[model samples]
Target: MRNRVSLSNRLKKVASYLPENANFADIGSDHAYLAAYVCQNDPNAKAIAGEVNVGPLNSAKDTINEYGLENQIEVRLGDGLEVIRPGEVNQIVIAGMGGSLITSILNKQKNISLEVDRMILQPNVDAKELREWLDDQNYMLIMEEIIEEQGHIYEILVAEKCNSHQSPYSDLEKEKQLYFGPYLLQDRNDAFMKKWGGERDKLTRVVEQMKQARQMDRDKIDQFINELDWMQEVLNNEKNNMETR
Candidate 1:
């Protein structure tokens, strides 16, 4: 019955990371599509759809009711992790938001953040910031995935408490891993290449445009140049690997 709700490919990828019998919270659940989909698939799963805004909260309720998953998925109206108490859920999912915002949300509820067994984050942008936050908070990256759908590319980061496993980032590769996810960089799948390739092209155009300005933003230009250099190195290395293969 709950299978009536359709999820996008990106959400499907996020859902794949969930455990078999998860008691989770979907923060910023926006219509609760993910919560509904997961609960429908896992009979043992229970979820809370947390939405900060009233409208989305109501929409989430509608979805739960439509799928007759009201018993399995509860809709809550609150900001970020405040929707659920610490230790109430073992896993949390925060998707379709900017990295900085997601970090802020996690920071605001450090207690709940620490208690959760796992977190699956899908940041729309500034993924580097999120990765850095995860490192600082001692959440080790367990898995990372990149997918392209409907002309858009998305990244999913799965992390667990540092004590649960080893940290994937090393001092030598830390910087690069934070910018381009450790697992994703190692994979360098078609989607990863496409996403970074597009970003590199966009930066090239911006750098040229900036040079033509009456007064250049030297600092910004320098930053963009550094990013371009790093991107070029990754692209060239991938090319070399492909040729050898």
Candidate 2:
């Protein structure tokens, strides 16, 4: 028998969002580790491992074969969501990519995107952009998580379709939630703090550099300053929450 495929802490967290008997498509499935894992865990679950590149597609196929899950998991060579037709799966997973690219993948196939019951996205960076796209697409943010693994922080976003009357942002201010996740802002976990703290420090240095420039760009500096202020407020709120508890 083939050895069971193991997933990193990041992929494990992403898998936690999958529902029972999940029939899902994993876009950009590099090695199909996640797909094999879900199938191994849930015999009823079915997965389509879609890869755009020849190298990764072959790797994914090898993984599926080694796992002896050929019957449960299907490996396809195609870009983004093109491999799977609309309504083929209830959930879609697009992880280990930038938020902008993930957004572009979903935007490219609105029919399949809207058809799925759920979508779990893990963006390496620009999660704020993903959140904004989800909002525009009317996908309700059902769950959000931040995890630190191998000295890097990653964010997982779980969303589902919502009606026009419903919104993903809830009552929270849209702008803040757009920049900082609505759920992540509420939790303010250590990973979230570290990520934003680093960003705040980086922006502070940029603002200082701009101030020293011979021909300063006031508009750009103002934008950076505004973002700094928002980060400060979020950090302060987290500190106060800890103090009160």
Candidate 3:
């Protein structure tokens, strides 16, 4: 089932955000490919590949053995952070999962997660919700990135625990950053516009189809209109400002 000859561009972007010489853990790691790759590149890197399912756990073990990364990468079978204890790893990666699941994993593993120095999260969707959770937990987003893969845009959030609550967004932009990420908005890369542009177009079609049903869908129409408005504003403003800044 594994087709990975090497790390995908998306995962490579994720790995690039890691701290140097980090002690890392990759939660829901399907085949430990990222773990092996990281270990190979960073001499001081050591990783734990955490998988909950039996099949994936076996797959991770095989990957570890195949790369002769047994000394560098450890394969463990457990759900989320259950396989890891507090202070075991300084950096943690929760990729290829939904935002809500990532939130729950962090919530459930709160006691141990306190020891984690950094988090590299890639949410398939609902990235806003995950950021909210991180905000509540006092994690400060240090950097953000978006990558396009197979016609899909993925958002990667790099955060670290902080003593005080310092948000990346100012009060004026807080609401906007909640839906579109803070650094993502500031960066405004092609992937960002493409993702939101596609979303706006999809909502446009949905609104058009709903109009045939008449006023009954007024509430939904209003919501879509709001989203489209914000997106239009962003693309207009950000696209123009890309080069000047």
Candidate 4:
């Protein structure tokens, strides 16, 4: 039986970054959709779908069987990178999860850098933490893309292991870039600006709320103001660049 699965255009775009010849590991591979997509499209690619939950693991196995892709894809139930052996896969994709969890999985996996050549990550939140971890680990950020799907903006990071290292941006720039994305800062599309604009307004409200409170609250408010001011400045600079272009 040939069942059809639809991937979001954003996901398809991210998948395009995968290496031509790769043994791909799809961490949290719900339903095995991405593995199936890569196996079918990339002639030289094979995949393993790793899911921690039994239900998703079974679903992935069923999808693999239904597609007659048993030879090309394997589904295993385990947490994070624990499902794969070192050197078995060169490309890893971790999506549809929080940044903290993704970073934790990578951090906990021993010698993952020796096994994997590249990583494609899409975090639902806390992307700053993930970026920071990448910098610390000496993973070079190769590409970044932003997509708006179902009224939510998602950032996809494509990185590869690198020996040469540079310090991560200052805390202020890091916060702004993580929230708004460094690549998006260069392009400065309306969607990117709109996302940060909404956040800026939210921070403004918090600043106002902190202003009327006691000393302890005032200290918290000051911290928020400092962050907000930094982000605001970045946004304004991006806006000016967009106008000139």
Lowest summed lDDT window (length 10), candidate 2:
163-172
lDDT (0 to 1) per candidate: 0.91, 0.91, 0.87, 0.80
Q: Where is model 4 more than 4 Å wrong at Cα?
A: 1-4, 166-179, 214-219, 242-245
* TM-score leaderboard ranking: 2, 1, 3, 4
Give residue 105's error in model 2 in angstroms: 0.9
Task: Point out where model 1 deviates above 4 Å.
Answer: 1-3
Candidate 4 lDDT trough over 10 residues, lowest sum? 166-175
Clashes of 2: 0
Q: List where candidate 3 sits over 4 angstroms from the true fold.
A: 1-5, 210-220, 238-245
* Candidate 4 residue-wise lDDT, 100-215, digit = tens: 99989988895764457799999877777878778778887777777788898887888888867754355666666655567767777766677778878998987777676665
Write down the TM-score of every candidate: 0.94, 0.95, 0.90, 0.88
lDDT by residue (176-230, candidate 1, tens digit) is 8899999998999999999999999999999999999999999999999999998
Taking all chains together, the TM-score of candidate 3 against the true structure is: 0.90
TM-score of 4: 0.88
Q: Please give, for residues 42-115, the per-residue lDDT of candidate 3 as tens digits.
A: 86899999999999999998888776778888999898899998779999999989999999998888976766
* Predicted model with the maximum lDDT: 1
TM-score of 2: 0.95
Question: Which model scores highest in TM-score?
Answer: 2
**Model 2, global lDDT:** 0.91
User: Which model is ahead, 1 or 2, in terms of TM-score?
Assistant: 2
